[model samples]
Target: MVSDFRRKKLLHMYKFLDKDGSGTIDKKDFQLAAESMTKQRGWKEGDALYKESLDMTDLVWNALQKAGDANNDGEVSADEWVTMWDTISKSAADREWLSQYCKFIFKMQDFNNDGFIDSDDYVAARSIAGTSKEDAVAAFQKLAQGKSKISLTDFQKLWDEYFLSEDPNAPGNFIAGKSSFD
Candidate 1:
């Protein structure tokens, strides 16, 4: 069950996602929201705008459908926001898969393989991303404002917030299947 605070947070998130403040989320809303989010992440306006033009709402809708659309009405309602939060909740959902993504980001950020990420790691990540340190820092700060450091917990949260959240037409599924070997 989702707590009231979390429900409110989800509703807030929904408001953000509904870029036009139209209440109902459709393809354009998803595109606009994604564009806004990517831009907020320090992506160049030209680049983010270019990417947003690509139509792929079906992909995003598919990944979020089960959780975001509780009524299964092909649209996300206010109450269904809580359901999406349930999926995002570490306690309510799978941890192993979440950690794998976190580890991936940790390795990427740990540019020197020193087992921890510091400012240098941030620089390296920015270099690889073809963005400046200022831009990278801006994006990080925008995402995690006022935080003193980026720890494993911080990485885990970022991994979920940015990487796990799928674009409407992204290639892979956001929710992974159970291990076949299990």
Candidate 2:
């Protein structure tokens, strides 16, 4: 069972993911974030770049639906989101669901698909989530540890801390933008 603190953290994350303020998480919210990225980057229509973003966002919606949409009604309510986290599969074969989901997103945020997330990629992804580029850059630089890249292990570790750790100074918290819980 997820602790109350962990459940609160998940709720914090849900607020961030509910980009459209629709009181429910759905595909359109994901699309809004994807669209924000493409628009901020000035990607023109029919461009393959934004299309990749769109497809990736769709994949996220699909994954969330598969895991958390208990009613099969296409959107995830706050209660359902909490239930999903509380009931996350704990089997040895599936114990890595949270990590895998983080890695999946980290992979997408890698931008250049170079197996690492550099400052540019980090800022780009953060911007889509409504963070200021300056704040994102500072956070990335602090987390990057003077390296120009962030490896998958490092990325996953941050995410682990983000979802499971209560450390106030964790870089994982910074990566999630302006979390009110912080």
Candidate 3:
């Protein structure tokens, strides 16, 4: 059974991906998020970075649809999202999807393409999801554990903890910022 903490985290992730404020997540949501992110980074439509961001978002959306859209309706509902996580949680072999997702997110959040995510990068990424600067800073501090930045390897561990840990005090609980699990 999924713990309440893990369930909350899963739903939070679903909400984050459903960028269009619709009840389900579709390719359009991914496109909107990609556009928003590129715009925030000042990447114009024809820019290589902008195109890369779009491609990354498309890849993410395709993976998510394959894994979570159980009904094959071209969208992932909240129930489908939770059920997918619940099943994945029980199967150790099913974690490859999560690792790929973590890589994509890490790439997006590493604004400088420097292989690390600093507090500024964290704040900027969270800002796209409407998280306040203060909350993002606090969450990053907790997740970083006093470190100045988080590398991809460390982020993968935190990503696992975020999706799997039932502990309320887990550092990964702050992955979406302070308010997410509060």
* Model 3 bad stretches (over 4 Å): 92-94, 179-182
**What TM-score would each prediction reach against the true structure?**
0.44, 0.73, 0.90
Candidate order by decreasing TM-score: 3, 2, 1
Which candidate's TM-score is highest?
A: 3
Compare candidates 1 and 2 on TM-score and give the better one. 2
Query: Could you give candidate 1's per-residue lDDT for residues 1-182 as a string of tens digits?
Result: 66553344445546655767778665667666556445544546567433532323435545566546767777777766565657666464544534653565465466566765556566556555455666565554544445644666666665564423333222111111100111
Segments of candidate 1 deviating more than 4 angstroms? 35-49, 52-58, 87-153, 158-182
The lowest-lDDT stretch of 10 consecutive residues in candidate 3 is 173-182
Q: Which 10 residues in a row give candidate 2 its minimum summed lDDT?
A: 88-97
- The C-alpha local distance difference test score for the whole of candidate 1 amounts to 0.51
Task: Kindly list the per-residue Cα lDDT of model 3 for residues 71-156, writing each as its tens digit.
Answer: 99999998888888777777876677578768988988998889999999999899887899999999999999999999998898
Candidate number with the higher lDDT (2 or 3): 3
